[model samples]
Target: MALKRKKAYESNIEKINGARMTIETQMMAIENANVNLETMGAMRAGAEAMKNIHGSMNIDKVDETMDDIRDQMDIANEISEAISRPVGVGDDLDEDELLNELEELEQEELDAKMLETPSPVVTAPNVPVHVPAARANEVEDDEEAELRALQASMAM
Candidate 1:
C-alpha cells in the first residue's frame, strides 16, 4: 500500500510539471508574434516615407540645379576680375608734370597777392596833431589872449 501511494504521488507531480512547461511555451510564442507585428508596422511606415521622398525629386533635376549654381559662380568671378582691373585703356600718366603745373599756379597766386597796393590811413577829427617848436610858442600866446577876453566878459 505504501508503494502504490508513493507511485501515485510521483505521477501527479510529473503531470503538473508538464502543464507548466506547456503554458510557458505558449506565452513565449505569443510574445514573439507580438514583436513580429510591431516590426511589420515599422517597416510599412518607413517604406511609405521613402516612397514620398522619391516622388518629390529626381536625379536629373538635382544635376541641373547644381550646374546652374556653378555657372552663376563663374559669372560672379569674372565680374569681380573685371572690376578690379585699371579703368583706362593703356594711357600713361606723368606724376612730375602734374606736380610742376600745381607749383607754377601757386607761385603765380603768391605774386598777384604781393603786387596789390595798400589802403590809406585814416585819423579822427578831434585828435590833436604835433606842431613844430617855433609854432608851439605862437599857439600858447593866442590861448592866453582868448582866456583874458573870457575873463573880461564874465566880470561885466
Candidate 2:
C-alpha cells in the first residue's frame, strides 16, 4: 500500500512538471507571435503607403485593410503588454523604478543563462605580431615618473 502511494505521488509530480514545461513553451511561442504580429503591422503600413504613392489604390479596400491591421496590432499590443505586466505588488512605485527593476531582473536572468552555457575558448590569430612604434617610443615625464615611483613605494 505504501509503495503504491509513493508511485502515485511520483506520477503526479511528473504530470505537474510536464504541465509546467508546456506552459513555459506556450509563453515563449506567445512572445514570438507578438513580435511577428508587430512586424506584420509594419509591413501592412509600408504596403499601404506604397499603394497610396502608386495612385492605383482603392479607397474602400485600403480603409478595410487599415482597419483590420489596426485591430490586429491592438490585439498584439495588448497581449505583449499583458505578458510584461509586473507580477509583484508595488502600486506606489514610480514608472522609472519599475522599469529599472525589470531591467535588472532581465540582466540577472541573462547572466544566469550565460553561466549555465560553456563558452568556446577562442585562440588568438597566428599572424605575426607587430609592436606599435608610438608605444615603444613613449616616455614618462618627471612628474609621471615621480607619481609612479610614489605608487610603487606605497605598494611596497
Candidate 3:
C-alpha cells in the first residue's frame, strides 16, 4: 500500500512540471510576436517619413524661387538708388542771368523801402538878413553865384 501511494505522488509532480514548461513556451512566443510588431511599426514610420521628404522638395521650383528673389533684390537696390540720389545736383544753369535778376530784385526792394521811409520837409533856414530896396536888383554874376551854390550844397 505505501509503494502505490509513493508512485501516485511522483506521477502528479511530473504532470505539473509539464504544464509549467508548456506555459513558459507560449509566453516566449507571445513576447517574440510583440517585438516583431514593434519592429514593423518602426519600419512603417520610417517609410512615411521618407515619403514625406520626397514629396515636399522639388529641385526645379526651388531654383526658380531663388532666382526670382535675387532678381527682385536687384530691382529693389536700383529703386533705392534712384530714390536716394539728389535731384538737380548736376545740371548746368545760367548763373549770370540769375545774378542779374537777383540784383534787379534787390534794387526794386531798395526803391520800395526808400519810398516807404519818412523824410523831413524841405524849408528855408530862419536867418535874419535885410537888403536895401535899391540894392536888391543887383544880382551876383555866374562865378560868385556858382561859388555860393557850391558852398550852400556843402553846408547842407
Model 1 ranges off by over 4 Å: 79-156
Full-model lDDT, candidate 3: 0.89
Q: Can you rank all candidates by lDDT, best first?
A: 1, 2, 3
lDDT of 1 by residue, 83-109 (tens): 887899434768788789899999999
Per-prediction TM-score: 0.46, 0.30, 0.36
Candidate 2 C-alpha lDDT tens digits along 1-156: 999999999999999999999999999999999999999999999998997987766888899999999999999999998888787756578999889999999999999999999989999878857977665556445568889999999998
Would you list the C-alpha lDDT of every candidate in the order shown? 0.91, 0.91, 0.89
Off-target runs (Cα >4 Å) in candidate 3 are 58-156
lDDT tens per residue, model 3, 1-156: 889999899898899899999999999999999999999999999999988987877899899999999999999999998888789863465889889999999999999999999999889989767776555545445567889999999998
Give the count of colliding residue pairs in each prediction. Answer: 0, 0, 0
| Model 2: CA > 4 A from native | 53-156
Pairs of residues at least 3 apart in sequence or in different chains that clash in candidate 1: none
Candidate 3 residue pairs in backbone clash = none
Question: On TM-score, who's better, 1 or 3?
Answer: 1
